[model samples]
Target: MELNSDQIKEILPHRYPFLLVDRITACEPGKYADGRKCVSVNEMQFCGHFPQQAVMPGVLVLEALAQTGAVALLTEEENKGKLVFFGGVKQARFRKQIVPGDVIELHTEIIARKGPVGFGKATATVDGKIAVSAELSFAIAEPESRN
Candidate 1:
């Protein structure tokens, strides 16, 4: 299944400058998800990260991977409307610098689960080269009341 930015917003709470994933190219509910993030010089991070040499922050790349994993877990029928919070990240490695005009391809697969907590294997690639790879842990939680 594929999801547009609007559809992704329905599954994720993030918005505006914080919503890093621009599109989900493939998704398998509780199994895995493949998404994309189009880096741009106009992004707020680029303004300060390095005005002379803009580079996408490594943390944001990890966040994009997390969001892709969340989409995989949250799409399940039992998880709909729930929120997934980062429990931990492990074995994270940055192999390349992501810059403006790069299209980050994010992929995540649910590797294990026990009730509300689970683990995922994630990777972010640019131009077919691995930019970041990590193991992410997450916990499903009820959304807090707005009022």
Candidate 2:
């Protein structure tokens, strides 16, 4: 199934400036997902990351990858409303500098899952070249409630 930004918002906990994934192009709940982000020069990070030559932060790329995976995990019928958190990031590598106008294609597959903890294989690519790749470890947890 495909999801737009509003649907993505319902599945992901992140918000503006941090909600990296713009849309999900394909997905099989709890198995895999394909998402995308349209990089913009006006994003806040570019202001400080560099004034002369702006580049999307490598860590954020990983976060986007993880969040793409989260959409898959959280979309499972049994997992609705649960929040996903980073347990750790493993074997992460960045091969390209993502910049404004670069449309990142993020792909993620759940590699393992047991109870609340899981691992996903993820990659972010631009123009068919991988910009970043990683094995992401994450946990399903209760969303913090406000009084």
Candidate 3:
């Protein structure tokens, strides 16, 4: 099933400038997910990230990829109401500079799964060319109880 930003918010804690995933076009619990982010010139980062050349940061691109993986992981019933933390990144590569008006398509696959820790192979593409790729490690945990 597809999900809009509001539905995405129900699964991920990130919001505003940090909420990179805009819409999920495909998702399979514990398997994989595909989402997109529409880069806008009005984004805050563009203000200082080389004023004249507002290139989207590579790290944020990878975060978007990770967030795509998180959507797959968190969609599982057992992982609900949990947070997925960045455990590590392996062999990350950025091949393109993402900018305003670009639509970043994020795709991720579950490579390994063990308890609360898992690994995902993620890729971000723009106009059908890979912009970034990485192997992301993640650790899932329950949110702190408010009580």
Give lDDT per model, in order.
0.95, 0.93, 0.94
After superposition on all CA atoms, what RMSD does each candidate show versus the true structure?
A: 0.7, 0.8, 0.9
Clash count, candidate 3? 0
Alpha carbon RMSD to native, model 3: 0.9
Write candidate 2's Cα lDDT for 1-147 as tens digits: 999999999889799989999999999999999999999999999999997999999998998998999999999998999999988898999999999999999999998998899899999999999899999988999888888
Compared to the true structure, candidate 1 yields what TM-score? Answer: 0.98
Q: Write the per-residue lDDT of candidate 3 for residues 1-147, one digit (tens) a residue.
A: 689999999999999989999999999999999999999999988998869889998988989999999999999999998999988899999999999999999999998998899999999999999999999999999898898
lDDT of 2: 0.93
Give the TM-score of each candidate. 0.98, 0.97, 0.97
Order the numbered candidates by lDDT, best leading.
1, 3, 2
Error of 3 at 72 (Å): 0.5
In candidate 3, stretches whose alpha carbon ends up further than 4 angstroms from where it belongs are none
For candidate 1, the per-residue lDDT at 56 reads: 91
Worst 10 residues of 2 by lDDT: 137-146
Tell me the number of clashing residue pairs for each predicted model: 0, 0, 0
Error of 3 at 119 (Å): 0.1
